[model samples]
Target: MRLSGRQIDCIRGGRGVFSGLDFEASSGEVLAVVGPNGSGKTSLLRLIAGLLVPAGGSVALEGGDAELTLPEQAHYLGHRDALKPALSVHENLSFWRDFLGGKTGDVGQCLAAVGLGHATHLPAAFLSAGQRRRLSIARLMVVRRPVWLLDEPTSALDTAGQALFVGVMRDHLAGGGIVIAATHAPLGIETRELRMGSAT
Candidate 1:
């Protein structure tokens, strides 16, 4: 499916971060939202994810006119890793399996794919920054969401981690998945770029 935003606007703290932003992202393609900090990148993802209500305009899925709902056909991974600190890596992914409304991905495979297999039984609180980021990304592999909303997905990752994420993302898109990410550097993939700084 495709995600298209038309004249989308979002306000925070009574400030108009952006208004009338428009874009179309289809499966097998990626949209990169890039800008300096406070450029409203995250706000745009939240608007698309339905976590924040837009002050104007709309985000629709594919050819449908209805706005998407939170936890619907979209998977959002924010800058902060959202794993349960006390939960073991195994339990973390297991819980997300059912929560995401899709088939259960093999935790072992997911962990291995993220290069975190050895820490599968460890609590999230003890994982390193990069490791935690990988764990958060593992959530995406657990289910095939049509739209992936990732914020700084490569922030704490090294070259290998970045490579792994790029490979997984390519596979996802090959399977007709869409990705919209807010990033500072190249995500190892050439994407249609959207400069949000100009909107501010």
Candidate 2:
């Protein structure tokens, strides 16, 4: 399967990020989006994930598939961990499993993948910023989704955390999943760049 955006466009605050933009991301490919701060990299990801519609363009899957919605058929991991501070790590993941279509992921394995297994029972508030990022990242390892839209996935992560994220992205690609991540540093994937604000 593949996702292709032809002549895609988006406008934020009446400023055009890009127009007439074109790109394709096939299965097993990890496409990374890079740009300076405030360069609309996150905006582009949002558009591709269907979180924001382009001002005048089209984005569609290659296999006659219908368009995508914000959280349908795609998993978006933003800067925020999206964890409940009041809930324990296990409870947070469990709640997501219950809420997100009742599809359960390997909670234990995921925690371990992100090196958060020992703290599974700890409240989110107790975890450090870097740890919280890992836990949020672990959500990707457990949940099975076709597309991953990540924003600054490595922020607040230490060296080990970055490596773990790299591994997860590699695993996802190996499984024929597609990833579109907006990041400042390298995302450890062969990417087809989409430069925002360029002649699109």
Candidate 3:
């Protein structure tokens, strides 16, 4: 399947962030959105994930599930971890699994995959930034989604944590899943770069 955005436009707070943007991403491919601050990198990903409405243009998926919209088929990992500080790592993940409305996955296995298995009972607020990020990564594994929209995915990760995340992303792509990330750091994988701002 392929995701395409044609002549897209983004306006925020009555000001235009970007306009006439165009791009396409297909299955088993990693699309990296690279741009400086205020260049609308996050805006573009949000548009593709259906979190933001385009002022003009369209985003369509070809050769995919006709019954579900693009956003419904995607897993959006934004800057925030989206976890409840009062809950444990396992609890946070379990909550998302139930809320996202999908077949239940192995939460323990997913936590182990991200190196959070030992911390399953620890409160989310007690974990370090890197550990918290790993918990967020675990959420991606609990529910199967074809499209992954990640913004600064490895922000709080250290060298080892980043390496682990790269493996996770590679496995997803190998499974024919599509990943679209907005990041300033290297993704540790070959990606089709979509540079925004004046160059585009």
Candidate 4:
């Protein structure tokens, strides 16, 4: 599968963030979007995920599910963890699994994979930042999606948690999944860089 964005333009809050940007990533590839702050790295991801409507250009995924749009086939992990503080770890994952409605995996196994098995019943409000990130990672695993749009995926993750996430990403790629991550820190995996320039 190939995900490509051509001559893309992004505008936010009435200001131009970027324009004439082009990018492409195939299956089994990790495209790391890196740039200085305010360079539109996150904006690029949001455009591809269909969260923000682009002012110009287009994004298309070739060789993906024909019945679904790009966003439907993609998982967007944004700056916020997008968790419910009132729900337990397992409940949060369960909600996502049901809501996403795709090829599903075992939530318990996914939590264990992300090192959250022991906290399955714990409320999200009580979890630390790293744990919150881990739960978000677990959400990625429990629901199968081919395209992963991650913004600062390693944020709040400790050394071990970061390392564990590397394995999780590897597994996803091994299964022919594609990852597009916007990050300042190294992803701890081999990746092609898509460096954005300052906003126009």
Candidate 4 on 17-58: residue-level lDDT in tens? Answer: 999999999999999999999999888888888889999999
Residue-pair clashes, model 1: 0
TM-score of 2: 0.90
Each candidate structure's TM-score, on Cα atoms with residue i matched to residue i, is 0.93, 0.90, 0.96, 0.99
- Please state the error at residue 138 of candidate 1 in Å: 0.9
Per lDDT, the best of the predicted structures is 4
- The alpha-carbon lDDT assigned to residue 197 of candidate 4 equals 82
lDDT of 1 at 102: 53
Candidate 1 lDDT over 94-158, as tens digits, reads 78887776545787898898899898999888999999888888989987677899988999899
Top model by TM-score, which number?
4
Q: In each prediction, how many residue pairs overlap at the backbone (N, C-alpha, C within less than 3 A)?
A: 0, 0, 0, 0
Q: How far out, in Å, is residue 16 in model 3?
A: 1.0
Flag regions of model 4 displaced more than 4 Å. none
Instruction: Compute the lDDT of residue 103 as modeled in candidate 2.
Output: 44
Q: Write the per-residue lDDT of candidate 2 for residues 81-184, one digit (tens) a residue.
A: 89999999989987776666434578888888789889999889999999998888877766777788899888899887888788888888898888888877
Q: Mark the regions of model 1 whose C-alpha exceeds 4 Å error after superposition.
A: 63-71, 198-200
For candidate 1, give the lDDT of residue 131.
91
* Per-residue lDDT of model 3, residues 1-200, tens digit only: 89889999889888899889899989999999998899998888888888899999999988778999989989999988898999988999998998897656899999999999899998899999889889999999899888999999999999999999999999889988999999999899999999887423
User: lDDT of each structure?
Assistant: 0.86, 0.79, 0.90, 0.95
Span of 10 residues, lowest total lDDT, candidate 2: 62-71
Give the C-alpha miss distance for residue 152 in model 3, angstroms: 0.5
1 against 2, candidate with superior TM-score: 1
Judging by TM-score, tell me the better candidate of 2 and 3: 3
